[model samples]
Target: MEKRYASIVFRHLTADRLAIRYPGLRSVPFVLATPMHGRMVITAANALAAAEGVIQGMVVADAKVCLPKLVVMNEPPGLAQRLLRALGLWCIRYTPVVAVDPPDGLLLDISGCAHLWGGERSYLKEIVTRLRGKGYDTRMAIAGTIGTAWAVARFGKASPIIANGTEVEALRPLPPAALRLDPDTADRLIRLGLRSVGSFMDMPPAVLRRRFGGGLPARLRQALGQEAEYIAPLRPAPPYDERLPCLDPIRTAAGIELAIGRLLDTLCARLAGEGKGLRKAVLRCHRVDGKTVQVTINTSRPSASVPHLLRLFQLQLPRIEPALGIELFVLEAPTVEDTAPVQEALWAGNPGLEDTALAELLDRLKSRSGTRAIRRYLPAEHHWPERSIKEATTIAERPATAWTTDKPRPARLLATPEPVEVTAPIPDYPPMLFRYKGEVHLIAKADGPERIEREWWMESGEHRDYYCVEDQHGKRYWLFRSGHYREGEPQHWFLHGFFA
Candidate 1:
C-alpha cells in the first residue's frame, strides 16, 4: 500500500486574534507580548510593524513608541495548547492516527484511509473545509515523506503539490529553506550561489557532506524521498468505548436508557477483555440536530460489572433531555484502571461490598446537589490544624494510605475556622475565657501550648502557639495565638478548629 500522510501547519498561530479580526488593525501595527526575564518580550510582529523596523525580541515599550496604535495582548500558553489539541481531535475525522506537532501543528498518517474519502486531494479539501467551518485558517500538504510534507506545508502554496516519482524536479525551484535547513546553512547556501534546492541537488553528494557535514546530505536525501523516512503513528488510547447507531432515532427516556444499557454491556465486555475497569465513563448522545449532550458518571473504584455501571447510568438518565431525538450513542471511558480479578471466598456467597455501588449512591447525591458539594478529605503535610485537611473531588482517585502513623492529628476538623477572642495573663498560659461565634465560652480546662514556628519561605507566614481547651459548655476547641509576647505586637487569637 502507498503510505500517505499529511502535515497541517497553522500560520502565525502564536499571534492573537486582534491582528486578524480587527479590520482597522489589519494594516496597523500589532505585536504579541510574552513575559520573559521580568520584561515583556515581543514575540511576533505584523508586516506593517516590520516595515517600521520592529523585530522579534524587541522590548514592548519601544515597539509601542514606534507604532502608537500597536495593540498588545498577553500570549496565553494554555490557550495555545488547547487550540492545538482541539485541532488534533478534529483531524481524527480524517484519519485515526493523528499526532500533535506541538506549539501549532499536527501530523496525520492517512495511509490506507484516503480512499474512504475519495483520493488524497478530496481528503485534503474535506479536511480544509471542516477546519474552515470551525473558523480555523489552515494550510495542508501531502507528500511522500514527513520532511517533504512539512517543507511544502510551510513554503508550498495551497495547490496540491504531490511528489510521486520526480521529487527532485518538484522541489528544484523551491528555496534552500524548503529543505528545513538552519538559518546559517541557508544563508551560506545563498552566499555560495546555491540558493535553490535544485542548485544544491546538482552538487556532488560527497562535497555537500564535506561542506555542510553529514546531516545536510541526509536531510536533503530525506526531503527528496531518496532515503526512506519512517513515521511513528500515535497509538490510539485504549478506549472503554461503546457505540450504537440507531436506525431509528431515540426520543423517549426509556428508549435512551435501553440503548444506554446495551452500550454499558459492550463497554463492560471490552474493559473485561482488556483486564481493565473504568473509573469514569462519558455518554455522548449525538442528537439529530447536530448538538451533543454528554452525561458523565464517576466510579469510586475501577469496575466493569454491568449492574454497577447500569446503576450509575440510571442515576444520570433523567438528566438526559433528548430534544430532537438522539441518532447515535457513544459511551467513552475518559479514565480507567487495571482492576485485579476478585477471587471469591469459597464460603462467602457474594464478593464483599462493591465500591461501585457506593459510588453510584454518591453520584446520585452529587447530581441532586452540586458536583462541588461532594468532596473527599485528604490529609496534608502540616501540623497546623487549619492547614492539615485538604478537600478533593470525590471522583478523583486518592492514595490508599493518606495518613501517617507518626504524626499527631485531631480526630475532627472544622470545615471553616472559627474566630476566638482571648484574654490571657501571659502568652505561655491558655485562655481562661474566650468569645467564639459571638458566644462567651469559659475555658475550664486547658492543654499545653504547642509552638509551631513560621514557614519564612511561604507568603502567609505565622508563628502560632496552639492549645486544646475544653469550655464550660462541654465543647472542645482548638485555639491558637499568633506571634509571641516578646514580639512588639499583641498576640492575635483564632479558634483554628474543633475536636470530636
Candidate 2:
C-alpha cells in the first residue's frame, strides 16, 4: 500500500474568534487559562491581544491593564476536550482510523480512503469546507509522513499543500519553527544560522545529530520522507457490524425479522472469519419518516453462533414496532469478549444447565424491568447494619459463597430508616420497649448495646448505640439510639434493620 497521510490543523485554535463566539464573547482579547490556586492562569494568547503586543503568561490583572477591552473567560478544559473528541469522531466518516491530537488537532491516515472521497485534494477541501461551514477555522495538509504533514500544516504556504516525494523541497522554504521543535531548540537553531527548513536540511546529518541529539536527524528524515512512518489505524471495534439500506421500507414484524436474519448471517460470518464472538448486540431500525427504534441483547458468554444469536434477537424482535416502515437496519456489538474454551464438567454433560437458564431469565427480566431495577446485594465495608449491604448489577454467575458466617449480621435490612420510640436504662443498655411502624412492641428478648462510632470524616455521620431486639411476634429489629447520655439532647432512636 502507498504511504499517505493528512494533518488537519486548526491554527491559533485557542484564539480563534469563532471559538470565542461561545458565550457571545467576540472581538475581546481573551486568553486560555489553566487553573492555578483556584484561579485561572493565562497560557495562550488571543490574536487580538497579540496585535496589541500582549503576550501569554501575563497575569489576568496585568493583561487587563494592557488592554482595558480584554475579555478574560476562565479556561474550559472540558469544552476543549469535547471539541477535540467531536472532531475525532467526525474524522471517522473519512477514515475509521483517527487519533486525537489534543488541545486542538487530529492525525488521520487517509491512505486508501482518499479515492472514496474523490482523491486527496478534493477530500481535503471537503473536510475544510465542512468544518468552516460548522463555524470552525481549520487548515489541513497532506503528506507522506506525520512530521512533514505537521510541518507543512503549521508553516507551509497559505494554501493546503499535498506533496508526494517532494516533501523536503516543499518544506525547505518554511521556517524551522514549523518542525514543532521546543522553543529552546528553535532559538538555538536560529543562533546556529539556521532560519528556514532549507537551512537545516543543508547541514550535514552528523553535525545536526552532534548538536541537536538523535531527534533532529529523525525529524529531518521524517520531513524528507526518507524514513518510513506507520499509523496504527483505529480499527472499528470488532464483533462485526453490518447495515442494510432497504429500498422498500418494511413495516410488518415478519418482514423486519427476515431483514434481521439476513444481517445476522453476514455479521456471524465476519465474526467467525475473525475468530471472535459477540457478547452484546444492538439493532437500530431507522424509520423512513425520521425516528429510530433500537433493540439490544446481552449474552452470558461471547457467541457468534448464528442460531444462538438469532434466538436471542428473536426474543427481542416483537418489541420493535416499525411504525413508519423501517428504511435501514444496523447491527452493532458494543461489548465483545474472547470465545475462550469452556472447561467440560467432570460428569461430561451438556453446558445447558439450570444456572444458564436462570442467567437468561434474569437477562429477560432486566430487559423488561429496566437494567437498574434488578440488582444483587453485596457486602460493604461497614459495621453499621444499614450501611453493610450494597446493591450492584446482577452478574451472570453468583459468587462462590452468598452468606458469610464469619461475622454475625442482621438477617433483614430495612429499605429506609424508621424512627423508633425507645426508653433505655442507660446509653449502654438495649431499648426495653420501642414503638415502631405505629405499633408499640415490647422487647421480649434483646441482645447487644453494640457501639458504632460515627464516621466523622463523612458529611453524613451519626454516632449511634445499636441493639438487636426480638418483638413478641418473634420478629427481630435492629435499632439505634443517636447521641450519648451525657449529650444534652434527647436520644433519637431509629430502627435501621431487621432479622428473619
Residue range with the least summed lDDT across 10 consecutive positions in model 2: 347-356
TM-score list, all predictions: 0.53, 0.58
Return the clash pairs for model 2, or none.
none
Per-residue alpha-carbon lDDT of candidate 1 for residues 237-264, written as tens digits (9 for 90 to 100): 3445666868778999889989989998
Could you tell me the TM-score of candidate 2? 0.58
Error of 2 at 158 (Å): 6.3
Which one is best on TM-score?
2
Which lDDT values do the candidates have, in the order given? 0.74, 0.73
Question: Given candidate 1, what's the lDDT at residue 75?
Answer: 70
Model 1 residue 242 lDDT score: 66
Clashes in predicted model 2: 0
